[model samples]
Target: MTFVIQLMSGLAVGCIYGLVAIGFSMIYRAMGLVNFAQADIMMIGAFLGYAILVAAPGIPFWLAIIGAMLGAALLGFVIERVAIRPSVARRADQVYLVLLTLGIGIVLSNGARLIWGADPVVYPTGLTHQTLTLAGYPLPAVYLYIAVVMPALLVGLHLFFTRTWLGLALRAAADDPDTAATMGVRPALATSVSFALASAIGAAAGVLYAPISYVSFDMGVIGVKAFAAAVVGTLGSIPGAVLGGFIIGLGETFGGQLIATEYQDSIAFAIMIGILLLKPTGLLSGARR
Candidate 1:
């Protein structure tokens, strides 16, 4: 029973990593540039959700998630237009653009510190400690929430990318901007939309994760593990991102139980390194972006 509970907990954490990794993969696929600030966007979303809950103590958790998503999406659009688009227009070097994202991330983290303070904050709700009886066993309510949310998100994303016009246009633009433009698919708009969608997803991860842990500006460090998941799954493949996330999540969880809690982070990276050694391009090397 303990093992089962630990497994579920790991899966929930993995889902969060997968969600953030999807953001990294999407931005890379659409813009061919890694936005290091992607994690900071998640931090911002967590903060936004915190603010929403504080403002409306009676609001549903799901509603708070949506509010965070929309707020983060708007922020993503503004960042793309004001910072990323101009750099692309000027044909900035890839290194410079990556550095720019790092700078932006630093600014965001520090700015958050100024606004929300350096101290970590916990959710005001009791869901953090709530448990549900399932299969004659008790499990954290947040785990159930994650299990439902992750699958729903995957399905929604699949439908959006497969059945929607804007989604198709975004794919075309990412594949070939010039050809897409001739077909009336604006690359710039696609890029902006991609960032917004990615940011929204990252925000969702933040909101879901908040119930399990304290929210802090430095929480973005979890992004490092998520990045490893992206690389292990294949940098631009959505399914791969999720797969890698689960692998890291489960591995670290069991490892911590069998080995030591202090080695959990190391176990995640070690798994990444081991996988990379065996499959240089990632487990889904030839998979689509």
Candidate 2:
């Protein structure tokens, strides 16, 4: 029962990393840019939902979640438009664009600190801590629901990329931006949509995480870890990000059992470095495509 609980908890948090990594991978593939503020976006999404809930008091939790996702999506699009696009247009160079994203990330995170204040905030999710008897052991209801959200989200993403025209266009842009542009798919629009999708995913993860982890300005650093997951999985592979997230999640979950809990945070990152050192291309060989 304890082992199962740890696994469930790890998977829940890992799902957040995986979801954030989606944006990390998407931006890297599309614009060749890495936004360091992805996790802070998640933090802000939770805060936005929290604000909505506080303002309207009667708003349903589900509705607040939807609002949070939309809010983050809008922010993503705005960031790409205001902070990234102009610099990109001015400079055709990749490193210049990368530096631009980094600057944007710093600005966004600091702005969030100013707006929300430096204190952590908690938003109740109404998920009860009551334990249910399962396999002759008690299991928390929160863990059960959380375990389902990740796989369900992954399936939804898989379908979107494979079935929908927008997703197909995005995938095409990720594969070859120059060719996608020639084929009547605007790479800029694709980048905008990618940011929006990634932001939505990040916010959705935030909504799920709010009940579990307290919201704070420093949450953006977690996005950095997610970036590592994206890199370790290869920057553009959706499936690979999920797999890498799970691997990192497992390392953190089981680290306490084998090693000390003090090293828990660094376990996944160490694995990421190892993967980078051994196979720079990552587990998925075709991410550049």
Candidate 3:
């Protein structure tokens, strides 16, 4: 029973990681740039949800998630237009673009500290503390929420990318911008939309994760592990990112249980390193790029 509960917990955390990793992969695929600020965008989303909850305590949690997503999406769009797009327009070097994103991340983290303060904040409701008894085992309600939300979210994404014209355009733009543009798809618009979508997903991850842990400006540091997951899963592969996330999450949880809690982070990194050594293309290398 304890093992089962631990497995659920790990899966929940892995889902969060996978969400953020998807953002990383999406941006990489569309813009060919790794937005280091993606996690800070997640932190900002958590704060947005926190703000919404505080302003209207009676609002549904799903509403708060939507509010956060919209808010973060707008921020992402502005960032792309104001900073990233201009650099890309100028044909900046990849190293410079990466450093710009790193700087943007620093600005975001510090800016969040100024706005939300340096102290961590928790959700105001009892939902975070809720639990459910399942087959004689107590399960965290947040874990169940994660289980439900992750799959639904994945389904939504699948439909969006497969069924919608905008989705098809985005994929075409990412795979080949000149060809997509020749087909009447604006690559710039697709890039902007991709960033917004990625930001919204990251925000959703932040809001879902905030209940399990406190929301702090530095919480963006968790992106480090998510980045490792992206790399392990194959940086440009969406399915690979998710698989890497679960691998890291499960490895960390079991390692903490069987070895030592202090080594959990190390265990996740070790697993990532081991997997990369054996399969450099990731577990889902053959999946969508």
Candidate 4:
């Protein structure tokens, strides 16, 4: 029962990582550059939901999450238009865009500090009272939600990528933007949509994560974990992200319990390093560039 509980808890965190990693993977495939500040954006959305709920106590929790997601999506769209687009146009240097994103993240985090205060605030679980009990082993309702949501999202994404025309356009842009353009597809538009999608996914993770771990300025590291998951699963593999996330999640849980908890962070990085060192490509074969 204890082991099941532990694995399930890890699954929740892993699912969040998987959800965020899908955006990271998809965007990278489309744009060839990593969104360095994705984690920070997620943190901002999480905080936005908390702020809304805290202020209007009348706003439903689910509504707050949707509002936060939309707000983050709009912010991403604006940032891409105002910052990324201009930088890409003026100079093709990748580092400039990378630095721009990092700066944007810093600005948002600091702004959040001012608005929400430096002190971290926890979002009410809204699911706090429920538990699934099996033979006296208690599981948080949030875990069940995360477990279901991740797979549902993955299936939806798979269908969107395979069955929808826009999804095909995104993939086409990812494969070859110039050729895609030759076919009348716009890569920049895809990039913008990718950013918005990434932001929304990150916001979702933040909402799902709020109850499990108190919302904090520091939660962006969860985004880093998702990045690692993306790396391990192979850059463009959605299933790989989910698989890698679960592996990391389970590893973090059992490794901490049986070994030194201080080494948990290192363990995850070590896995990433080991996978890259051994496979060089990633766990999935077709996911490489």
- Model 2 alpha-carbon miss at residue 53, Å: 2.5
Clashes of 3: 0
RMSD of each: 1.1, 2.3, 1.1, 2.0
Residue 159's lDDT within candidate 1 is 92
* Between candidates 1 and 3, the lDDT winner: 1
User: What TM-score would each prediction reach against the true structure?
Assistant: 0.97, 0.90, 0.97, 0.92
> TM-score rank, highest first?
1, 3, 4, 2
lDDT of 2 by residue, 222-263 (tens): 777777777778877777787777777777778866788778
- Once superposed on the true structure, which residue ranges of model 3 sit more than 4 Å away at CA? none
**Per the 3 Å backbone cut-off, how many clashing residue pairs does candidate 1 have?**
0
lDDT of each: 0.90, 0.77, 0.89, 0.79
Compared with the true structure, what per-residue lDDT tens digits does model 4 show for residues 1-289? 7798887877887888887787777777778767877888889888978877877876766677778889889888887888788888887688777788778878877877777787778775466556788568898776766766566667877798789999899888888999999999976988898888788878878877887777777778787788888888887777787778887777777887788878888888888898899888778857443
**7-83 per-residue lDDT for model 3 (tens digits):** 88898889999999999999999978988999999999999999999999978888888999999999999989999
Best by lDDT: 1
